[model samples]
Target chain A: MVGIEPRVTSYLDYATGGFTTQYAAMLVAAGVCDTVACVFGANPRQATVGDSGAYVYDPTYGLVNAGAIAALGWTRYMSKYETVEEDLGAVAVTFRRHARLNPNSAFTEPLTLDDYLATPYTVWPFRELDICKVTAGGAALIITAADRAGDHPKAPVYIGAAGRQQAPLELAGDEHLMCYAMTSVAEQVYREAGIGPGDVDLLMATDSSTAAVIHTLENYGFCEPGGGGRFVREGGIALDGEIPMNPDGGQLSGGYLLGWLHQVEAVRQLRGECGERQVAGARIAQYATTGRWRTDFLSTIYVAE
Target chain B: MPDSVDIRANEANEAFEAFVGDHELRVQQCDGCGRRRLPPSWICPHCLAEEYEWIAASGTGVIHSFIWYLRPLDPAFLATPYNVTIVELAEGPRLISKVVGVQPGDLSVGQAVEAAFEDGPPGATTLVFRVRETADGAEG
Candidate 1:
């Protein structure tokens, strides 16, 4: 979605798909433009809906999709005894721990898994902790052509094959809700980057909610489709685990910028600027973002140049 | 059915709510291919048929999925730990509603449920569901 503002600056905002900044960056690298800037602002904490069941997080889609997340959990991955708290709770807290390391983050307080599980549900299958906080802020990134890249101070992080994929956007129509979207996105990125998931050194996926992080692990083939719960429970996504995902604190702890600020985290890591969250000697990484969980968006593979 | 169901966001949904006002569950059937759908789109997604027939639903299906909102921090919900659900209507369409006559915590996935109607926010009537039965015994 592109928005144009007529003024002294007169610069139009080019918002692409999920992890949209990468798409903008890809365009600039391919001569689609001379330079591109990606920025985002959000203040969901204050967005109000009417006095109906529609939630403040999203007055329109949140209520319905929250139920869908519940449905998907019961039918696809979980048993009746295992609630959303069992798996998603841990993931939420893990991101919280990461946020503690990120001083600029909104949720910097350390959250134990027990405290997260104890929080009452704001929406079912989603406790208040399971959802990213209501952050009111913006972040931006700039991408320029390789020839002009020398003008920048830091080493350029090359954009490899970046792919975007989507599932059936129709309401409640998706088959296998667990693997509907991420699986396809994974396939395309591997083909485009000439590398598979195994080669990536660091990982980042949608953390719109902890459930999303679980789905991303399975959907991205980090584990089997139904294995996300186990993968998460066993500490597969933690910073010290096999794959360090969202080490810069995901949207859950980092604050929500429509997951665009993740690009900033990714860029900083690639530039070796993240003093503490840095994946040791990280040369390759992959990340994804969604405009909304209901449908399509971009996933990018990055390599240090 | 409640005396207060007056809000229908669209003419098509206005018709659907009319059925709910009578304690009847209804869905749109494609006039062309006979496929049924819910959350009324006014047209059949299957065959591009603008024409459809509103048929009363079986008002019976198992719990497709559910969630329990544990607090009323948001004004949008009134219940502490409100039970929200997705009922897979026997006619093959999924409806987003809540428990009408069943205990919220007792709700389980794959349990049988049937439709019910009640007032929501004064002039609005909503279609909700109740436990029709369970694997262990009969419920509402």
Candidate 2:
């Protein structure tokens, strides 16, 4: 991807985690091409997902399926039993602060916890600040042969391990869907990398919604289940925390690139390009996302050269 | 009994349509394991069996969770700012529905609720939830 641009670019609806890494790998896996560009751009005409025009979770379209509403509602219910809402509020505040360091970011204005609480709930638990922004911009990443992935970049980061998993999307099966398909992907990547969660320097975590971030924090083995709320509340996943999660502001404040943008942030961090937001001597990073199906999730880790 | 009407049920949901049209709430039950499932799916998770049968639900449940909407995101839902709840059916399956005859604040975890069908958009008979009252042989 450094020397030449990929000629063939395919169209993918930027909802869930469909477009970014999954499609890129899909293009390569099909054996049709060795390299392809995964590009996502949003504007008025030809509406993209996450935009106000494309928030079509109606019966006609299928993002908010039968189990989705229940999953979200259950998250909200459990959040009330715990301080997860406070954790969500803290993610908004932390990421907005991180956005200040990201000039390419949308909504760079600093936010406070009071501001987050005052924001009206779009859905019951997910407030305006709890979700990603309806952004209009383009993010592209070229997937090429690893051998040819050298030249032009500041410093190249290698794709250490990649893993994905899809789970059944029915409400009748599980009591709750706190983490989506994260556990399967986590196991795959950790095994591939030959390291555990302790070795990860930072996670360019994808927070499609604030509640999702808390769930991922717990279910992804960053902490034990029911520990996510406490982890966020205590600043354990903050900018300079023990795990240093979502250093790029994630989707909460980073503007929804459907989560591909978090990888760009990961690459930049690994290359030591981020000025104020960079984790010190950060050698390893994890970028993860969930697909259109509520339970189809993927995670890819990167190692700095 | 709030003016129930028929909906535009899809082919995959024909079995469900027929049952609900008869005013009976039901789900696909695994013939092998007797486990109930939503979405009227073909396969059973427990027994890995392909064959299934429909079983009538108790029409009674608890409000497992809920959310209040303030927008007409769905034009079909005439009631704006409505409350949607995930009801845990007494038979052990769950379904996404709304709670009528109650406001958002009145909802709580593990509250007893019963099912009620209503006339919904697209001519679909939408299943709804309502607060179940205790019978003490006296009026509150």
Candidate 3:
């Protein structure tokens, strides 16, 4: 049956898609809407090699997504803590292993650290495997007010809290190299949710490049700053580890739907619906993403209701 | 002023670039607090003052971070393995440019650099940086 009346109340876009979903959720929370559909899609295949619309400036022209993010990783990890490039392979390997168990993932081929290292560097510090596969696809989620959430057939995933933090300007502050804004955003989200990093059962960080995974881990308090490379190399983000990250392979292998798939994975994990790639008895899940060069950061915490 | 100039600068940035085009690196200095900002601003971001002036910079800074592009993402930069770097000016603002006259692997954070200019296709002159050499011919 059609609804009594319907209207498109709002529409917007961002460099990152998860923020739009967060905005739609806030609309419902504020009683402005009964339900909101957040849809995200990208078609890099139809465009030229460097036509992503995000990086066309004079200074940033040649530093496309891969190189820009790899530069960030190199500055944070390689320059700061003496981290070797080979240590970054853990993120790709772990995510690929998780993708092997996720039927929805686009690239399910088994990947080992050696196999990941065998690939050529798309950028100096990143291989083709380190970058998200730029494919054409769409994914979406439905957000409803708390009162109407139970009416749905399946279990509802509740948004415990959401928060965003933006830097003053791109590379303006002294801490831009460290992306210090994300730490404050993480504190806000966790405090609002009445939880800590340890309380999170799983984490779904935007894996646009393997560097993003490292940044999220450290910025979200999962590990110390400059310690993300060591944490990943030691299996800290594996499915059976303390904080299972990207259990659905994230954008790395799950296909980059502008982080929409990560949100879906968080919901399914909270609902205990993921058969093999699920974090067992997962209750609280978190999803986080940042804009290019850490211009902004956004995070949302979800719990099964 | 040419139509082929593809920069992301707004009016403020264009004002700053105009000086660079004239072989000068200048920043906005607040008339009140004497604070300086890059890319030019009508108001001082630090003091929130509306009075400001363009002041010539020392044209020297330290390398904040850098990256080497093994593959060219822009057709204009057909040369493979080029570098993009962020330098923190001595006057306290960061600028994005390339470091010339050095191999990609030779640069490090905190290394000192001085400004150099490249006259681009008419009406476009850009700021490129070079490593500051000590009196002993060693990298400073």
Interface DockQ of each model:
0.31, 0.30, 0.44
Find the candidate with the highest DockQ and give its number. Answer: 3
Q: Is candidate 1 or candidate 3 better by TM-score?
A: 3
A249 Cα displacement, candidate 3 (Å): 0.7
lDDT of 2 at A40: 68
Give lDDT tens digits, candidate 2, residues B23-123: 67887888888888876665676777877777778899987667666444344544546766778888888777778887656777678888888765554
Model 1 interface DockQ: 0.31
Better of 2 and 3 by lDDT: 3
Candidate with maximal TM-score: 3
Off by over 4 Å in 2: A1-10, A13-34, A45-81, A172-176, B1-12, B42-51, B71-78, B119-124, B135-140
Model 1 stretches with alpha carbons more than 4 Å out: A1-19, A22-32, A42-76, A79-86, A174-179, B1-11, B119-124, B134-140
lDDT of 3 by residue, A1-305 (tens): 26635445555645356787788887877877788887776677542132232454454335555336545446645666768675678998988899889887777878888898788765566676766765567777888887888888998898898988877774535334456778888999999999999999999887877877777788899998878888999899999997999998877776677677888889889989899887998999998987756667889999887
Best-to-worst ranking by TM-score: 3, 2, 1
**Fraction of true contacts kept, per model?**
0.44, 0.30, 0.42
Q: For candidate 2, what is the DockQ-based docking class?
A: acceptable
Misplaced by over 4 Å in model 3 are A1-4, A15-17, A46-54, A59-61, A66-70, A170-175, B1-15
How high a TM-score does candidate 1 get?
0.83
lDDT (C-alpha) at residue A106 in model 2 = 69
* TM-score, every prediction: 0.83, 0.84, 0.91
Scored against the true structure, residue A258 in model 2 reaches a CA lDDT of 65
